[model samples]
Target chain A: MRGAVMYAPGDVRVEEREDARLVEPTDAVLRLSAACVCGSDLWPYRGIEPVGGATPMGHEYVGVVEQVGGAVKGISPGQFVVGSFFASDNTCEICRSGYQPSCPYSVIMGSIGTQAELVRVPHADGTLVPTPAMPPADMIPGLLAASDVLGTGWFGAVAAEVGPGKAVAVVGDGAVGLLAVLAAKQLGAERIIAMSRHEPRQRLAREFGASDIVTERGNEGVTRVHELTGGFGAHSVVEAVGTQESMMQAIRSARPGGHVGYVGVAHDVSLPGVELFFSHVHLHGGPAPVRRFLPELIDRIWKREIDPGKVFDLELPLDQAAEAYRAMDERRAIKALLTP
Target chain B: MRGAVMYAPGDVRVEEREDARLVEPTDAVLRLSAACVCGSDLWPYRGIEPVGGATPMGHEYVGVVEQVGGAVKGISPGQFVVGSFFASDNTCEICRSGYQPSCPYSVIMGSIGTQAELVRVPHADGTLVPTPAMPPADMIPGLLAASDVLGTGWFGAVAAEVGPGKAVAVVGDGAVGLLAVLAAKQLGAERIIAMSRHEPRQRLAREFGASDIVTERGNEGVTRVHELTGGFGAHSVVEAVGTQESMMQAIRSARPGGHVGYVGVAHDVSLPGVELFFSHVHLHGGPAPVRRFLPELIDRIWKREIDPGKVFDLELPLDQAAEAYRAMDERRAIKALLTP
Candidate 1:
């Protein structure tokens, strides 16, 4: 089976790999139908996040189950399914609390690499949620998105407490931030503000239910958000860019007693305790428990209620994996979907 | 009027001051019945927090209204009242949202020095909550506690979401943290864990409804909390010590999806953003919106339902304000109440 592998910084190659087989009684082998290059992938590809050696790439997938081990139940072969980046035994106490990413026996599916022809998924019954049926070909992109980004954006909005009458501010123009605007809108936020400097991304943001757009970054952006909300900052802020500046902007953009839902993969960010203490905002985020939102997201996608796949502005054949990485790294594409 | 003034670090003097008079149309002059030395006062008295010059001190007070400005309605002369350290116009949007400390027109009562014979309170009607009746002499300590420590503790518990069946861990054994145990118990937390090494404070914590006491501090304390909670941390953590170590300990002691309510006056603390992002804990706090909880807290004290005043272990005449600060700073007393 062919899969993406990175031997070093900026080195992504698609080559033949050993066949995946059942490793545990609860494991299932999935034949990939769709996969994508994640923004987080750039962390290692850009050498910002260290890569030990030829590391397996990708953690997002939507595929058809090809085989299942003896202990795997509920999920069966031939069913199309969406799974989170983290494989969790959904029956654990943490999973029951809707925090599957912190499941006691959770495993990072990225280490196993999902952007391949075949992959072994541990804890199949708990990690994978089947679509109502084999989704139509047109629904594949959105279904694949539910594997990570859509669920992540949904989690961000929920964490931010985006609800009716809330003025929400999203601090990032990436696919997740754009999708957060959609999520906030779906969750009934009265107003949504998307921060983006690019004309194209701003257009998509507006299309995805953004009621306002602010191009400024950092403190200026927070000022604009405050100006938009009558000197009180936004009621809910979704921070999808995990940088020191972005996190601070999100925190500062929220009104006292507001919420800052941050989903960006933070690196080298340290928040001043006194400022955060006086901010009087609720801060909640992490690698989102995508599995917790998969069921509902899949249902919404199946019903054609939301088209999160719009985030994928570029698509590529699985063989063009290197180009996908290059395009996304250079900011030529918001996200690139790959068909295996 | 005589007020406590800090001429220098470790140099506190009770000196005659200009008479207190209404300064704003919404202001009221109050003759302080009781004022106490706070843990935060030690920061400046011990020279940890810088003192600009001869600064007036103290913010916590339970007093009798002596005069009211024209616009100060509802709170009239002769009314016995309890108010927050921060005086807020409760009618503002921020105050209405239950974050009075961040109210646009909020005023720090410390600037007027509550540790005085008489002091002016701004936004009187909004800041002062009248008791059901004049609290009895025995209840004075408890009512005074409500003016700051008890109210701060209640806010911490509420912010941490300490409710039925939750395990709550309090990170400080100061008056506020001890009161938080009582608040958690009153809020129905099934288990309250107080982190304290001092036997007396630990005893007070247990009396305030602490079900367990952990003598360890920092990471070891966090490990202990996790061990107690079956490898998962506490469901709610109240951080009443605003230092880097205490903040991190509080954050590390909460389970994923748990809440950390911190209310200590932060000095030089800073939180690492990456760890916080991945911690998946909800962080909420500030100078507690004590005014928001004043009415209910007062009512509870009126009914003799809580004995928060027990935290004040020393009593002194207002003239001995210097000794009061010295006693608290030297840890000779948990808290010292001053009678003007």
Candidate 2:
């Protein structure tokens, strides 16, 4: 099997790797149909996060189950499925309560990188959601989006309590943020303000239901959000960028009693407790329980109600995996889909 | 009028002050019936927070409406009332959203000092909630508790989303935390765990509906909480101590997808964003929009359904205001009542 691996910062390669095999009866071997580089992958690629030595890359994936373990009850071979980045036995208390990432039996799926031709998924029945029927080829990317980004963005919107009549503000221009805008719109938000400096991202943000755009950054951006929200701030704000500046902006851009749903993985960030206390906003977000939303998202994608696949502006063959990483790192592409 | 003033840290005095008078059409003068020392006041008194020169102290009070400015409606002179520490117009969007402390027309009543014979309250019509009838002398302390501590504790419980079948943990033994235990019980929490080491406070917590007690602090305390909740954590946690240790304990004590409602005035706290992000708990708190719960709290106090006044362990004449502050500051008293 061919898989992408990163040896060091700015060094990603596609190479032949050992075949993925099942070690547990609850596991399923998948022949991944589609996989993509995630924003978080840039953490190590840009040297911001350490590449622990030839680490396998990619977590988001959608594929057909090539083999299933005896213990897997709900999933079987020949069915296309979407699984969460975190494998959880969905029947656990935490998973039942809709926080699968924190499930005691959960396993981080990134360790079994899906950027390969074959991937082994554990807790198959609880972690994978099968589509009602096999979809057309064009819907593959959208189905893949449901595996992580779309579910994550949907979780962000729900965490922020975006609902009818809410004025939402998104603090990042990444795929997740743009999708969050779409999610807020779908969740019945009355208005959405996307904060993006890039023209291409701004246009996509608008198409994703952003009613307004603010090109400013930092304090100025927060001030613009306040002004746009009648000096009260937005009713809901989604933070997709993990930087300190983005987190503060998200917090400051929400009105008192509003919510700030941050999906960004925080790095070297320390929030001043005084400011957060005085902000009087509800804060909720973390590693999204993507498994919880896979079914609904798959349904929406199957019905063609949403086109999250548009985020993949660049697609490359498995052999061109390095180029895919470069394109996304250099901002030449929003996201890159890989086909084996 | 006479008021309690802190000339410097540990140097409080009872001094003659100007008679309370309305400065705006929205102001009202109240003849305070009672006032009490708060744990937050100890911050400035013990010097963790600055007592910037002769600062008039105290915000909680139960009083009689002495006079109202021309614009005041809904409240009248001679009416006994209970008001939140933060005076708000209550009609603004923020107030309407149940966040009165963040209301644009809000005024910090602490600046005016309710620990006096007479005090001026801004936004009278919106700030003061009249009791059903003049309360008997014995009920004064309970009503006074509702003005701030009771309301704050109730808000903390409500913010933590305490309800039937939820396990609640309170992270302070102060009057507010004890009251939160009561609030959680009233909110139908299945089990209330009060985190306190002091024997008297632990006893009071038990009386207030703490089904269990965890005397350990910091990491060990969190361990005890997990052990108690089937190795998970409490469904709800109320943080009434603003220090880093207590904040972390509250966050760590809550299960994933649980809630943490923090109300203690944060002094020098800084939250590690990454840890908070991984905690995956809903966080909500602040100065607590006490006004939001004032009406129901007052009614409960009036009907004698809850005896919040039990938190006040010491009582003294207004002239001994200095001693009242000292007793609460020294932890010799859970709360101290002052009467003119």
For each candidate, the DockQ is 0.87, 0.91
Instruction: Write candidate 2's Cα lDDT for A1-340 as tens digits.
Output: 9999999999999999999998999999999999999999999999998888998888988899999998998998999898999999999899999999999999898888989999999999999999888878999999998888888889999999999999999999999999999899899999999999999999999998999999999999999999999999999999998889999999999999999999998988899999999999999999999988888888888999999999999999988989999999999999999998
CAPRI grade, predicted model 1: high
Model 2 segments more than 4 A misplaced:
none
Candidate 1 chain B, run of 10 with poorest lDDT: B270-279
How much does candidate 1 score in TM-score? Answer: 0.99
Candidate 1 global CA lDDT score: 0.93
**Comparing chain B with the reference, what is the TM-score for each candidate?**
0.99, 0.99
